[model samples]
Target: MEIPIYIFYALLSAIFAALVAIFGKIGLEGIDSTLATTIRAFIMFVFLLLVSAFQGKLKGGITSRQFAFIVLSGVAGALSWLFYFLALKTGTVKAVVAIDRTSVVFAIAFAWLLLGEEVTLRAFIGALLIVIGAILVSLK
Candidate 1:
């Protein structure tokens, strides 16, 4: 069976996210976590802006509702990063990241509630196991 391209993209995102934990922890050695996160966010903004421009995706035609949602999403993401960096500053990478990965479980629940998406039994089981695994990994 052919694998979906999205799976590959997801895997790549996981890899880079792992690197973020490692690198962010190291980079937090002498500076404040919030400062580090701000700098990192700036770099990310520039990189994504360049990529979007390169792909001709910089056109602005979104409605106010769409703009509001996008801004809210950005705010949520920024808060996530700020807290993540703060955690990484003092916590073990494995423990911090394992706890952070619980976002997947949250996403599942949120999707079902907010987006009216169906949660299958298999997916529920997977999310349950992920919670268990994260707890085990996060334990001292």
Candidate 2:
């Protein structure tokens, strides 16, 4: 059976996420977290623009609702990065990443509550296990 393309992208994202923590930690030695985040965001913006342009995906025809949601998502992502960098600045990478990964559990809950997504028993159990693991890893 062939895996989906999204799986490969997700795998790559995970790999880059690990690299981001290491690189961000090293690069943040004497820098403000907000400034570091801004620089990183700018680099990401340029890279994504290049990719979008290369793929001819830069058309601007989104609906107002789509634009609003995209703006909201960008703001939320910026806030998440800001807090994540702040945490990483003071916390060990392992613990910080572990705690951050608990966003999966939060996503599950939010999906069920806000998106009306199904929350099966198995998924609930898995999310519970993730919660437990995150808590264990976060303990000093």
Candidate 3:
């Protein structure tokens, strides 16, 4: 994909995610978080399935390695959501979200150390900025 297209997708994803967190907190007023997560998963699965089908790529030929990766992704996603919802339950939305977005710093560090991604000074500076912004947003 083109660079602009990727940026567009990222922007939309971030916006949608922020909206999800806000609405999710409101919707969780009378529902269990775990159940709510499962329902959201079901909805996402359906949407993804439709997209795959429309693209003529609906196939389930998963190898063990691919299966493991998928499982790990799902586990990480569930854990993240669990913590997000729990935090939202007890903390302010802005604080919970700002803290949660700290994953960008974590991602940068892990990618550098584990995946051997390039650890340029620029990347370090960007991560620092993200952390600073998160801290400022979470301040009372």
Candidate 4:
């Protein structure tokens, strides 16, 4: 049996995301959370810029609508990082990450509501389980 390529990418993303929580917590110890987050975002921007340039992905022309949505997404992502870093700075990583992972449920709801994506019964049940698990894990 063959696994889809996206599953592999998703697994890698999960690993890196876990590392982000640990590393961000340690790095936030002496610095302001907002400053730490800003530095991290800059690093990410530079790294992604290099990667896109190397991959020849920087040549594509984006439509105005696409550009507008991308800008909105960037703003949303910045807010997410700001809050996440602040949470990591003040809270236990286990609890913080547990709550942060609930973004999966948010994404599902947004997809269904804004994108007209169908939420299958299985997917809905899985999302509910994730919320329950997050709450359990985040408990004191």
Candidate 2 on 17-132: residue-level lDDT in tens? Answer: 99999999888899999999999999999999999999999985899999999999999999999998998898988889989999999899999999999999999999999989
Q: Judged by TM-score relative to the true structure, which candidate is superior, 3 or 4?
A: 4
Better of 1 and 3 by lDDT: 1
lDDT of 3 by residue, 39-108 (tens): 8778888999899999989665889999998999999998888778878877789988988998999998
Write model 4 residue lDDT over 12-80, tens digit each, in one string.
999999999999998998999999999999999999999999999999999999999999999999999
Q: Residue 61 of candidate 1: its Cα lDDT?
A: 92
lDDT of 1 by residue, 19-120 (tens): 999999999999999999999999999999999999999885999999999999999999999999999999999999999999999999999999999999
lDDT score at residue 25, model 4, on the 0-100 scale:
92
Worst 10 residues of 2 by lDDT: 55-64
User: What C-alpha lDDT does candidate 1 achieve relative to the native structure?
Assistant: 0.97
- Compute each candidate's TM-score over C-alphas: 0.97, 0.95, 0.89, 0.97
Which regions of candidate 1 are displaced past 4 Å?
none
State how far residue 47 of model 1 sits from its true place (Å). 0.7
Local distance difference test scores for all models: 0.97, 0.93, 0.88, 0.97
